[model samples]
Target: MDSRIKMENSMNMIFFGPVSSFMRIDAESLLHILTFTKKHLIPISRTILIWDLITDGKTAAFLYSREYLALGPLLNFVPEEDLYYVNFGDKSVLSFFANHNLGLHSRKYGILAASYRRYYGDMWYEDSDYINELGYLICGFPAHIISKITPAVFKKIDVEIFKKLSLCSVNQTKTLYNLATHKNAYGKPYKWSSHEITKLDILFICVPKESISSIRLEAIPAISKHIMEMIHQDKLEYFTKQQILRMNPEARRMYIIRVQLRTSLDTSQIAKQDANAIKKSVPLALIYVFTLILK
Candidate 1:
């Protein structure tokens, strides 16, 4: 989609100040403001209030602990607790907007808009005292969840594999879907470690329009290679490279199978190829291929 369309589809809200400006508001005050707004003023289907504490790590932690529990479930559009530790930096906030939009459109609306944007200027945070009040105003608006992905990670993915994985929200119920087909195409079932799944989720969540479109046009094969490697290595089990090599292939394979079935998309052509290439070299590869073909 074009930039304008993407920006329009993004989480709809206006920030009133710099990220640092919200540090003064304590957790209770923030919760009070959100509670009041939810009970009365804002007229939206759902409201999600996020604090932009920026570099005020101390305050951010305190507010997150105290206010989040009280206000999170009350809002219809809150992010899952597991996914709430994101920073309030400019890029992160923008990513949040993108993710919220994607969640709303893909899982919620079936159709997705082309692009999304965040609008803020230097003067945006002029009203420091009323930051919580402003949050209330912006709360409960439907948003897609977007997670940030690093350039290095982005570089490792295959373009076509990325597209297939990027097919928005696939029906979780479809037993044999695009993901399965992707696994089959490479001649084996794709696998991922827990950490890899978390990273993939972040990638899917924060993928930019330019990055998505660019990957579609120029990087499919490379992306595929990286995804395969990640699966073969079971990058999800451990966050570091060293730990991946030590993981049992069977355990890694099971994790990949579960993730593939859950998200309903095959995310790594590299893994499949690795499995096939090592079929004769490794007994586990043979078992993985056999299990996939039988499935």
Candidate 2:
């Protein structure tokens, strides 16, 4: 059979077949298997395949044991909020903690819910669940990781605001972050959420500004921190102020590529005449790695 036809058949199986067939497969092996089989699947297909595995209990458990979900394997593909809810489900406290100990890093909601239950014994699970879902809306901390939060704290949370932030409707996070960090009319700190910065820390690192326009300006600090460090350390080529502004998106992409590859492939080394060829070739290579893996 033609290679293209064979690839199509493999994809059909992944999309149409039951996920249980892939349950025992761990994350690393699954990634290799998919990439090896077709080697050219599209991003959408890759996203779907990953979604299938993570949402399925048995398959997610297998992969979670290997601690691969937060490893950039599905970076930018899965929505950060949904991943937490899907993975947490309604499992017992012990099961939740067992999965948490696997070194899975992201998913603030899951971590918050588990921590809350660990200390409080589900006395206010509904409150925790609500706050967990609400945390997905704001850019910073989900709910403060407080040892003792008053009942008023739950009442003070605005469900409408949570919906706006969660849905990402019209500059919600940008506005919220600004207000949360600013002081009130009395010049005292305006407490927005909880005290922990873990969720916000992860959000600052993982969110892609180029892809999501609402937080482009807000994410500048996050994006610039890494890129500036790279240039200062001589990992990337230096650029003028105007050049850096224009190259923000490309710079961010390069940052992710660098983190993923962990190698120094300086663009400055590629000759000007061959630069265009390399620029086009990079996407083709990524499409293969991302989309066309085997079952």
Best by TM-score: 2
The TM-score between candidate 1 and the true structure equals: 0.22
Give me the runs in candidate 2 sitting further than 4 Å from their true place: 1-28, 31-42, 50-85, 89-137, 140-170, 177-295
Q: Where in model 1 is the C-alpha error above 4 Å?
A: 1-90, 97-167, 171-248, 251-295
RMSD of each: 19.3, 15.8
What TM value does model 2 have?
A: 0.26
Q: Relative to the unseen true structure, what is the Cα RMSD of model 1?
A: 19.3
Q: After superposition, how far is residue 38 of candidate 2 from its true place, in Å?
A: 14
Kindly give the number of clashing pairs for every candidate. Answer: 45, 7
Q: State each model's CA lDDT, in order.
A: 0.32, 0.39
lDDT of 2 at 122: 51
